[model samples]
Every structure is written in C-alpha cells, then in structure tokens.
Target: MTAATSVVAGETLPSSMRASVLTGALKISMDERAVPTPALHQVLVHVSKVGVCGSDIHYYREGRVGPFVVDAPLVLGHELSGRIVAVGEGVDTSRIGERVAVEPQKPCRLCSQCKAGRYNLCPFMEFYATPPIDGAFCEYVVIESDFAHAVPDAVSDEAAALIEPLSVGIAASRKARIVPGSRVLIAGAGPIGVIATQAARAFGAAEVIVSDPVAERRAMAMRFGATSTIDPMTEDSRPLKVDAFVDACGIPRAIVSGLESLRGAGVAVLVGTGFDEVSMPIPTIMNNELVVTSVFRYTDTWPLGAHLVASGQVDLDSLVTSRFDLDTVEDALNADKNPDNLKTIVEAK
Candidate 1:
C-alpha cells in the first residue's frame, strides 16, 4: 500500500502494479512496474477487463502493424473496462467508485480534426497499444475523465470492454449512412464484421448480408443478425447489388469482390486493417461512382455502444469464447489463431 498521506481511492493505493510487457515478437513476460499517479482531470483506474483485439495479436505475432513498430518493451491492449480508484486534481472525488469503459485514444484538442469533431483523425493522437504508447495491459492506468465513460448497471465488465469494437461498428455504420431499407453487405465474419452485422440492423438496414468463406463464421454472423450469409469460397457476390459495402475482412479478394457487388453510386466503407495498400480499378470507380472511405479508432461512441448492449439490441456476450488472467496474456493474444474463438478477454482483476 501507499504511504499514509497518499491515500486516494477508498483502499490504500499500491506502490507497484503487475504488467504484461511484450519485449519483442512472440515474446512477453509479466513484470512489476510502479503505479502511475493521475494528472489533472484524470482518474487512476483499476483495470477490470481487457478484450484481446486483432491489432494486439498482430503486434504479438509480427512486431509491427504497417509502420508502427515495437522496438522497445510495450504493453499491448486497448479494449478495456475499469473502476475509478482515484481522482486527480479538478476531478470530482465522488467518481472514485464509478465503473467505466476506457477510450484508449487521446487526441490533441487543438487539431483541426478535433475542432471538426473528428478527433479520431487527429495527427497528434496518442493511442494505447500502439507502439511507444503503453496501453492498459496492466492492473492500473490513468485516463482523461472525459474519456472514461461511465457504464450503467446493465453493462457487464466484459461487455463494457467489447464496447471498443462496438464503437468501430458504430463508426462504420454511421460513415456508410445505412438508412432504412438500405441493402448493405459486410465482407468479414470476424469480431468487427460480426459487430458490424448487428450495427447494420440497428441503422435500419433492411438486408444485411455478410460474406465470409468460413461456414462457421457465416453461421455465427446469422446468429448475430445478418439477413444472409455467403461463402465467398463457393458463392458469388458479383451479382448482388447493395447500397453500401463494409470491408471488415481486409482480404484483397474480398475487398475487390465487395467493390464489384455494389450497385451504381453506392458507398464502400473500409474498416478492415489487412493490407497496407490496395489498388482499385479506375474504371470500376468511375462506373460505380462508389464513395470509398475508412474510420480510425472512434469518437463519442461509447455511450451508444453501452446503450446497444443495455437495451439488448447488440449481443456482446456471444462473442466471448475464452478468458485469461493477467499472467496468461499470451494466450489471450493468440486466441485469434483458433477459428472457433471469437473474442478473448484478459480479466485484470
């Protein structure tokens, strides 16, 4: 416990906290690090749960995702839920016990993108789990009070952690402008794809078709709310016409196929983080007049994500296939290797 005069939370603060650090690719170890103190308008939270994301796995398996390389010891995790144990100056002391979903991005408030309400595109973004930025793969972390969104009683800690991915789905849906009766096609059955499938319905899409080669994932997508599923390995998507297409698979073939599936003047929202670069046919772009775009992390999406889970419109529980403690972080990161697995969580507490 901390010194007598340093008591911040209801319980005595610990001098040190356990962390799972990645020294390099395929290398990780548990280490003890000093607990951090919150700055002004920040809160020291005890991380309760963290969802293993594909980006975390990429860092674990490959040392880097595109240009973001992990050259030093780094903690890899972003999707997180926690309880406020301490509040810093200018923060209300009453928030010491609030349960919250942590938004891992802190964009410079003065950037033009932030001023435009698109902080997700801020060039000065300090994001968690991205090289040089230590994320919440530990017991304690400090976050801006505004970014520590409170979750209602209806939202479970695990569900709260999944809110990060849910935000991506929400962002994609919003970017697609999925209006009532719009026909939308999603090109992946992974976590984001599955979440996007549910999001498509929430946005009032009349027909939400999910395309994946895996029959199992296709079935899972149906359970999540996809009106139809196509095995790109066997079925053809070229004949299908849709108002919007969201590429969550990131597979070149799937993306090109999704592009071919859209009708004239449709929207193509690319959320998949597969290839660093991809080429689209100039003729296809001209003929279809597709408005292609992509979304970064997210902004102001936590409350809506929480509402979807609380109201039972989105099912977060169905996505969890396994759980791990802080010590077994490696297992959590490698969970994507198993096809049967959908989401793996690291329960910090």
Candidate 2:
C-alpha cells in the first residue's frame, strides 16, 4: 500500500490527534485535530520526536520573531523526527515506515538563491513553526518527501530529532571554513554552542573554548569538547585568542564578545537569533580584516547530521537533556528557558 493508504489504514492513526497550538502570546493549548492528508510530493509522518527550540519559545512568549509575526493560531514546533506513514501521489511509497528527520524549510526551488545551492537565503521559503506554516507539534505532519531524510537504522528516534540543530552546527562550521588545528571560540554555552563546539572538534579544531554566564552551561561545554569555558563577567582578559569564533548565543553582547575574541583574519559565524539592533566594534573588524558570516538556517546538512549521529560521532544522547509528552509542550518550552536545561524534546505518542 502507498504511504497515504498506510496512514489511513494504520491502527495507530487516531481520528483526532493531540497538537500544541499557539493561540496568542504565552497562550498554547493541547487540542485535537483531524489527521491531515499528504499533498503531492508530500508524505504523512507519524511524529516521534520534536525538539524544543529557542525560536519556538520566543514565538510562544512574544507571538512574533523578527519579521515573522503569529497573526493566527499556529502549531509551534519544527525540529522533529518520525516514521513515514503515507506518501503523496507523486512520491515513492517505498519510503513508508522509514524513520526520518524533517528539514523544516521548504524554499521555492526556482528562486535565484535556491538555484545557487544557497536555498536557505531563498525569499519564498515556507519554514515550519514560522508564522504561516504550521509546525509538527502534532501527532502527524504532512511534509514534502524530499525534505524528509531517512535515518540510519542505528540511529534512535530521539537522536534523529536532534539532526535539526546538529545540521545548524554543521552549517555554521562549514560557513566558518574551520580548518584542522584552528583555534575556535564559541560564544554562549547553550545547546547550539555545545553542538557547535562538538562540530568544530569534528572538523578538527585544535582548541575549542566556550564562553557563557551560566556556570552550568559552561560545565556542560567542557563535557561536550570545549577546551576551556569562560565566564565573560568574571574578569577582563586578553580577548584576541582564537583563530575563529562562532556566535551561537545570538545576544548582541555575545556577538560583540565573539568579535573581540577572534584573531586577525579570523572568521566569525553567527548562528543564533536575537534583537535586531546591536552595537559592535566595527573598527576592530575592519582593522583585523576579520570576516563575519551569518547563517539563517541550514541547507543540505540534515542528512549529514543524521549520518554523524548514526555513526556515533556527534554524541546526541548527551545533548538531549529533557523530554516531554505532547500534552506538556508548554511546560517543556518553559523548562528549556531555565538555565539548567540543555535541550528539550516533545515526544508524540
């Protein structure tokens, strides 16, 4: 049977499935909705794991992020993994039952940026959990088959869910062009910071240092491969110590501090999101001839992320610090906001 038929036929498919829908700022509810059908080129996936992202929490509390505003009630999750249950008309049904991670961004393939293989910059991208596009906080999600990457049998559903953020780390590493033995500094020892540290190590960085105010996060950073963890508030010290720096915290202060931490001609990749306006030492960047790069999201990195986890190179198990059921997504998000939590996931049963 085709994937679509399989979804309809599966005993696991409930008439109505639980979903965490965002009604307004700080207003989320666990409601039931009819299982949706897959459109052409789409596949229906029975969601197994959903990661609670910083962006998800920002939207929940603020009702908007950057240019995207939640004008309507929307489902609020994107980082996810699941098993394909049904395929659309043009999709290959053979993919059914495959455990996969979904790449949430669906860019218009015909866009100029997409044609250049930098689809992450595509202006017409429909990303899940962003304003208009409903996310995978539900039991089932219908997504484009091409965006759903099959995970290796060795990877667990929980690890597969982490592929989303892992891809971001990979993308940031690629953007910075991290070379073997390069001295790397990652600002912010949060989830992305920890993953970026690991990704930089995977890319052969000689020394990886992470800086954050949270002592717990810095401690976790050491466990995740940070050569040193710095508390910027602790003391003022020599700042130009690293060959490359990654601003994974997104806070303006972190970005500014990352710029200060880089060596001459070093590259700094911005991987986090935050307030639009922030002051920086522009003259230092010009004088040092440093390159500053920003990553919107990921492109062509999910499969590699899954591979890294399956091969046991990324150590996803240590990164997933918390998990919640579909009904407690709000609590999960709120908990993640706490400094103690590393990364949180919502499991759909």
Candidate 3:
C-alpha cells in the first residue's frame, strides 16, 4: 500500500473520498472528493448512519435555511453515528474502532456562553450541515474528538444516530424544568416532538400531550408515550389545560395554539427552526405571565441521550420510519416531505 493509503494506528490517513454534494438548489450529485485529515485534537470517522433531519430536507429543497444561504456546493446531514477509523497526531489510539454518536456543534470554548456551560448558544459555533460548514453526508468526517461520545454496545447504530435529536429533546426538557405530575403539551409530533414526549415522560411529567396536523405523526406520538394526541385542525381550545407547553412545529399557528393551552404562569419552550419572524400572542403571554424560552441545539446532553437509548428507556427504533442507501439519499429526503413518514435515515454502505 502507498504511504498515502496507509493510516497509522491513531493518525488520520491521506486526503480525499466520496460525498454527496449539493451543487445547487434541489440538486444533489455524488462526487469523489478529498478526505479531510484530522487536526491535533480531531479524529477521522467512518460514518455509518446519518439520520435524515428536517433541516436537511429543507436545505435540499431550498439550498438555504433562514440566514444561512448556500452559495456553493455543500454536503448535508447532522444526526450521525460512526466509528473512529483514525485519530490525529498526539491523540489516543485507544478510541479506534469505538462506536460513537457525534455532536455536530463545535463551539469556541472561550466564549461567554461556553464558559457558562450553555455552549449550545455559542455565537461562534460551527455546526455541521449548516451552510458553509460541510456536514457528514459522506463516507468520512474529521471532527474534534471531544465532540464524539462513545456509545454503548446496547445502542444500535440507528439509535445512535438518534442521539443527536434526542439530545435536543433532553435540552428542551431541562430548560422547561419539567417535574413530576406536571401536565406537558408538545406541539408538532415530528421526531423532535415525539422524542420530547418520551423525554418528558421520563422526566416525570404526569401527562404528556402532543399536537400535530398529520394524523400519522399524532398517532405515532401515542405509541412513543404521549398521553394524548391533539389534531389542531380538529381540536380547538382543548390544549388550554396543560401546565407547560413545548413548541416543536416552528409554525406561528402552533406557537399561538400551544400558548393558548398553557395555564397561568406556565412555561413554553420553543424547540423548532422555521423561517424568521414568527408572530406570537404577546398579549396572552403577558396576561398569563408565561415564561417563554427557546433552545438552539444542545449542550452537555449527549451522554444522557445515549444512556436513554442504550438502556431502552426511549425506543429510538420506532422513530425511524424509513431508510435509504447513499445513492438514494435524494429520494429519502423527498420522502421526508410526505406527512406519513416520521423520520428517515440514510445508511452508508
């Protein structure tokens, strides 16, 4: 084997590999590209599974999400699980072959948010799959070693990929300060909402209610531990009984409806990303003295999420409604637009 082809026990090998490139809006092409070598604190990972996220589908269709516009070709995917194929110089080789769920956000540790242990809000974060930061929808990805958390053998690769989204739910639960016997209402029974339902239950919420326009998703939410499912299109003024609410739809309508369901002095946590400038019922929020907060990504929750899935406390497998190979990534993303499907995954083979 050539020196370039050979990899040291821990050090990253030579550059270049294959990846799915987003050449333009609604266009994806498979292309061979240079693999990245890991830096001093990084490791090269052989990606095994990537969860098809809503953001990925949005980027595939529009080539941009919010302010992050894609002017050049970029690979897209964030929820990922992989094995450590190689590590960087001065790094420990003991991690080689270890399975892990990668934390896609790389925050600057010196930032105020980082110091405050709220790294998810770090302004200088370079999150994977976001515009300008090519993500792990490829055969290999090199990331900081600390950002990858080791997964137990009990966690399947599918479940490992879900750790990313699960972490988001966990973070949201923490922000809401969920407690036993608290009535929690979750809007949008998508992956995040479904997972949040399960997380809220685990956190001791007495009753967990979910709302979604999609019949399939609302039904799936019940299977995943939601105490009840509310279809906003059909159910009116019914959600107003919950003590707390979580807005996962990113739609203005859902936000308004979820707030309407909250009791006085209740909390509402917004956990979804949509187009900018979503209007809310500010007067109602003021009248109820509701505490409104938003969570961006996650912070220090990967290990907890891993534990939840590995221990079988949260059934991550049920959330995966479909899977596709790398070659069929486009089709998989397209299928995600269908309301019938809950979560889609892409397997690297």
Candidate 4:
C-alpha cells in the first residue's frame, strides 16, 4: 500500500501534521506541526515511506556526526518517497498525483560546482536530515519540483524510498568503473553493500564477491548479485585478485582489506562513512598503481535508480526486513541491533 494520503486537484489540505522530532541523543517525540505549503517552483508532497539510514542512527546515538552537531530540535529522515498533493505557482497543477522519490539535497545551481555539473559538491547544498536541515519525518513536505522525481507504478513506496541508497550504489559503481567481464569485490554486506552488488551486475560485472562477518548478510549479498560470499572473520581477503573493490562497510580494516584484494591498476571506491582518520596502505597502493576514489551523495541518479527498479534489473523489495509507523520511529532507528534486519522502513502517514 502507498504510504500517504491521496489528494485531488484543488483539494484543501489539512492545517497540521504529526511530526517526529529528535530532541537530543536517544530522545524522540511526536509533536503537532503545521503542514507546509509549497513555494513557487515547488510541490507539496504527502510523505509516504522513509528509510532509516546509518547516519540517522549515528545522530540518534551520539547527537552528532563529524562536525555537524544537534544543538536544537530537528527531524531525521532523508531517504523518502511520496505522492504530490499540491503545487505552487509556476508548477503544473496536474502533477499533483504523481508518485515521486525525493532527492533530499538541493544544491545552489549558480555555484561553480553546480555549473561544472558536480552539483553534489556544491558548498551551499541544503541536504535533508543533516544538522540544521530538517528532513521529512512528517506527513507533508515541500521540495523543488525538479527534485521530486516521478517513479513508475511498478515500484512500491518502500522501494521508491530506497532509491536513495540505490543511487549511492550506482555512484560507487561508476567511480569504480565496473564494466562487462570485470570482477568486483564489495566489503560490508549491509544495505549499501547489497545494493552495490546489484548495481555492479547491472553495470555488467562478470563476477561479484561480497565480504562480511555476518552469515545472513553474506547470504543476502549472494541473493542480490554476489557470485561468492566470504566471511571476513575466518577467511583471508588478500587472495581475491579482483579488478575493482568497493568498501561499503566503512570500517578502516575493511578498506585496507579491500585494498589488499585489488589487482594491479585496479580501482577502489570508498562508499561507506567511517572514521575521519584512516590509515591507507600507501606502499601497496603506490606499487600496484591502484586508483582510490570516493563518492558523496549522488547526482543525476534518481532516474537511473527508477529505471533500474522498473526494468527489473534490481530488486528493492527484498532488502526490507522491518517496518514501523511514525509513532514507532525510535524502534526503527534501533533495528540495527537485530542482526537479521537489513533495511528498516518508517511510514510517515
């Protein structure tokens, strides 16, 4: 079922909504908030599904991530999908019924980075769920019309929200240069890891090996696209001579292990968020002529993510292991403690 309410043309929207707010570390409260009206060139979306990400957990657990700290109350949720319920001036009113996957970050188009087509690096980017930037953990949210990407009917609400993570996987695949007949190794069989496996296969990788400590996650990786799964705990990762290695786990050791497994002239893409300080294998990297790169949030990836799900090249529904309503958002955030769950979805309406 869809995650939000359906509205018709010219229908008057409600005045208020129930908002899930983060007051501090491990503190969450449901409060009444006014429904936001879309501004010019914007559309009001009836929020449906919100995917709980690791960053959300970090904020919930520590009240901060890197330099961004929670000094005031905020909403937390970036991965989202919803249906357009209203439109602002200059927007086509007929788009009110379109189901869309919201691209949470909006960059300043006038910046040099945006002009050069590297909008993800725009210094003035307003990203949702980040400190001082409220996200969509409420029933209604407004976004620029261009950021509300339409999705085909075949994609479920939860799957649509997951496109955010899929976009991350796609970005990593592009950076790592996963091509036909290429052998790729992915570290960390978490949500991003599994999605990266599928993205690699779609990029025509001949073989994908997924490494993880959990037996369940490794099995999940195999189901997604991994030709083989290895338990990093008991197995040595240096034996695999793959052309590309993607670190989705973010652990420093995992990154080092992936580096050790790469072939000469191979590439390594860091996708996971780890410690600010990491020790690189400088000698091995220089000797092998290895290329190491990293990807931030995606750019020009929503349509690709939609197409991948629509065309059946990637399966998104299989990633879900738990679901919660907005009232139970805290439980969804803590779901990672349960090793069996891969993805947790929170319904905003």
> Which candidate number maximizes lDDT?
4
- The TM-score of predicted model 4 comes to 0.96
Candidate scoring better on lDDT of 3 and 4? 4
* Per-residue lDDT value at 240 in model 4: 88
Best first by lDDT, ranked: 4, 1, 2, 3
Per residue, candidate 1 scores C-alpha lDDT tens digits across 7-100 of 3444678889999999988999999999988887888889999999989999999999878999999998999999888878888877878899
Looking at model 4, which ten-residue stretch has the lowest summed lDDT? 1-10
TM-score of 3: 0.94
Error of 3 at 47 (Å): 0.3
Clashes within 3 Å, all models in order: 0, 4, 6, 0
Task: Judging by TM-score, tell me the better candidate of 2 and 4.
Answer: 4
Please write out the lDDT profile of model 2 over residues 1-349, one tens digit for every residue.
Answer: 3335645346656667888899988888888899888888999899999998988998998888888999998998888999988888898777878888898878889989999998999999999999899999999998888999998888888888888888889998998889899888888888899999888998888899888888898899999899988888884424656888898888887788788878888898988887788897999899999999888898899878877777777888778878899888889879875677898989986
Query: Candidate 2: where are CA atoms >4 Å away?
Result: 1-3, 7-15
Each candidate's root-mean-square deviation in Å? 2.1, 1.8, 2.7, 3.1
Alpha carbon lDDT of each predicted model:
0.90, 0.86, 0.85, 0.92
**Model 2 steric clash pairs:** 3-86, 3-87, 4-86, 4-87
**Residues 1-349, candidate 3, lDDT per residue (tens digit)?**
1112234354555466779888888899998988777777788788999998888888888877878888889899999998887778766877778898999888889999899998888889899989789998898887888988899999988899889999889988888889999899999888899999999998889899898888888888999999888888888744356878898989888888888888889899999887488788899899989999988888888899988887777889878878997788888889866777888889874
Q: Which stretches of candidate 4 lie over 4 Å from their true place?
A: 1-6
In angstroms, give how far residue 14 of model 4 lies from its true place. 0.7
